[model samples]
Target: MSQILKLFNFIRIFWFLILPLVCFGQEKEKPRLELGGAFRVNYVYSSWKEEQKTKGGEFGYDMFRINAKASYKNIFLNAEYRLYSEAFGGGFLKQGWVGYKFNKKDELHAGLVYVPFGIKQYNSHNWFFNITYYVGLEDDHDMGLKYLHTGDKWDYAFAFLKNAEELNFGGGVENSSSRYSYDVVGRNKETNQFNGKVVRKLGQHIKHRIGFSGQYGSLYNIDTNKNGHHYALGLHYEMNWKNWNLKTEAITVSHAPENAPGESNKIIKMGAYGTPYEVASDFNMYTAAVSKKISVNWGPISQIEVYNDFGYMQKKEKEFTDSFQNVTGLLVTAGQVYTYIDYAAGYNHSWLGGNFVDDFSAGNPDAKWEARFNINIGYYF
Candidate 1:
């Protein structure tokens, strides 16, 4: 309770400080404010383990998100709050930030923002992105301060973050209840981090981005105190021609204990499955996707896109086998709404970048292939 109060107080103070600056402008121009949001729902069908199988279809709320933005001259504030049925009856602060633009080429921001690692955007066209996104290596948000620079041919960002996933004032055992839970994993604790990325545009049809990301923290073990570290190097490429788009990225992530015995090992929970397993210290991941947009003149159907996304993870260990996932889908968009239908098939477990699932039972290995069909519809207002 005390920690919650402290978090609330911090936000309140920040709000008060920014309110005066935004309200008392040098010019008479009124500040601009915009309110928008989105609602999403999904229907899913999956073949569970033979013993757990059932014939009934499943439907549920996907998400409800609200976005707010306010700007006055060069200072601006942006925030997003979301509610999810799978988030265990709690809301999430996806993004909340304040920024000031120094010029066209430079800007600074402070608050919770996406980490600068791997590909800057979604690595796949499907609703479930590449495996890297599941393990806090890609498309993950963190509380931090970031500086960005944009030039005629290049772009770069540098950031320093406290904690990996979200801001938690009440620090105790890390939580791992739902997919939307922001707590750091037990084996990979990201206390503080320095992340950087750079992109170079070579031509109108092709471009490249390379990034180096690293984090230093400690493992979340109540019995033993051990420091852990994470490092990754990634290369991303994109090509565009007419209505076709191609994107790919390859990243290598290494996680290890800073100081520990030679035989020290810990059982950690996998993010997607929430099952405990031992993992190797190193792994590699690759992802690729291609999409084509077809223009349409039909009523309420401006465009249709077809895409196939693939992801692979290779773990450098004898105890674990590699895993991969493939998603093929179509996206239809009209005005402020879009719908997606996709089929995903994977082996062993969800592609978790370097994170791998262990054998669940002697006869029933978790590495068995599984498939799921999903349809999602969303509207923006």
Candidate 2:
């Protein structure tokens, strides 16, 4: 851990030292450097099963991030450093990339960046994101090289990513279950991965965007000395008009097991909660959200946004019941600050951390609802 801290400090010092030079040393023709970040705090309450209810509210600093970007002619550098309270993680580099522009509409980048999957921007209004996020398939980032192109009516991105989502250099116990971290399990010793997405817009007042994404890679099972295939396909759509926005996505992911009968379900280990658990080989998820923005000037609030989000997950095996989650929230923005208050409920099972369905189920197959209340405040600079 000390070594990791030292490395982090070095990177921090290096960036801080170079930022001033990049901002002022360039000629006037060069684009000016941009700096921004946000600080957030949250309070949470959960009332699930009798034993899992929160007696007192959980409150603390959520996260803080610093963003820096600069452009010298067509060459650009962008980076962000994130610090989270103990509950999330100590600190980490969320994004750090350097890119070169080939033209006004095309650019190439290398380093740690977001994977090209699902919705690119504003997919969910909730802080936990959608179900895809819990399944290690949504809004995820990785180390890779990427190519991006933006057009008047269309946009596309393609990337080559490392088999392992994030690099772990300290040789410590890997947090296999945490949604914030990544680990390869089962016979699938991940190799290389290819991901790409394309989006096209249609209509005018009721503008719409549709996207398709796919990923493929190889996996190995060490116990049997066998290899298999890992792949996923996703479809997403978004529509906006006046003051309302709607988004939806569906994804199918599979991990083929070596030597397993084609008609039988393959058992595989997946990351969840802070550890890994075994589940069927194939999983499918569907999510949708609708939000309405209202411009208002009441007290210190200048705008109010209300949204409802829903997600459903289906496991290949019938023994394990499916899961569903829904969230309704209101976001109020005042100047550079915003506050979000939400009520979330889940049934059968959910990936949203606080759900206590497993504890209450007690071998019962029937679904029960688990609920939580969350409030978060953030300030941007």
Candidate 3:
């Protein structure tokens, strides 16, 4: 009779689509689920007649990073994976996110995150009480959408971005057969990036933070089709005492090239072409650290650390030999934190560029004096 009326209309549309998920799982009650993870294994020996030789020194395993987080209530999830060796395998760009929580702690995030804009342990090192020469700051991470607010002492974050895809530090084999060679030097693929921040906690161990960030598009060089418009501005500060900690950060960058070309301007002009082109640059950083906590007999273990870091770069390149006006770095770290081992030693005095140090000769190689030593063993679940 019409095949039993099409099987009774497919069982009444599958019971009207599971009847509102069984009455919303019996009118839900709470306590969704939770899980967490963390792991890091490192041991490094250093060398840098100018850069690149920490693959292993008298030993190996420069670094290792892994992280995970999950929650269900107002919805949440997070990820982190990092490693500096083995040919960049787990170097998956460092983060991933999904969030929602407008109550238990105000959060509303969305994928490929972290534009929180600075000063959370120098842009965060997956937080486990980080202290590695406290390298001033500038670990800009992008690809974002965020809004986070937390309280007890006030915290805030705001973001909007997409200016990734650059990190090739030019090595010349024709700039390594150019494919944009990882393009990073105030990268801006097309405009569209934003940032915000605020943090306060004073009178209980002091804390204060401020932020503003930037990036704007237009920088085309599709084989010299030339174009312009670039920008950046930043400020940051942090302080703590009891064992002591202090920080400072500053940045100002500009590149306004539009029709730039000249031997005395016959046509193109916009900050007038200067070699590899980066008409202006400025970056400054400062750091300080002091630690104390020692109670022995193999119980409360150890905590002995010392720190220092200062990195500065100010250039106005027009190829005055690739302009590197002020480049500096001075780092010193001493560590011994134990429940089960975490030893460190660093003697880094700067002059190598960008991703800190993996050595592709980015700081353009003119300054010298390098040192690094590391050790780690971690466990927490």
Candidate 1 regions off by >4 Å?
1-22, 49-56, 86-89, 175-183, 205-223, 258-280, 350-366
lDDT, residue 251, model 2: 88
lDDT of 2 by residue, 309-350 (tens): 998877765565676779899999999998999988876544
The TM-score values for the models, in the order shown, are 0.82, 0.84, 0.26
Across residues 167-227, which tens digit of lDDT does each residue of candidate 1 receive? 3445455544333422345534556677788877666655444444444444444334555
The segments of candidate 2 whose C-alpha lies over 4 angstroms from its true place after superposition are 1-11, 14-31, 49-56, 169-189, 220-227, 257-280, 348-367
Error of 1 at 88 (Å): 4.9
Over 244-363, each residue of candidate 3 has an lDDT whose tens digit, in order, gives: 566555655554533324322111111101111222222233333333333334344334334433433333343322212111111222233222222222222222222333212123
Checking candidate 2 for backbone clashes, the offending pairs are 177-274, 177-275, 187-220, 187-221, 188-219, 188-220, 189-220
Candidates in descending lDDT order: 2, 1, 3
Best model per lDDT:
2
| Model 1, residue 127: C-alpha shift (Å) | 0.9
> In angstroms, how far off is 66's CA in candidate 3?
11
Candidate with better lDDT, 2 vs 3: 2
Residue 73 CA error for candidate 2 (Å)?
Answer: 1.8
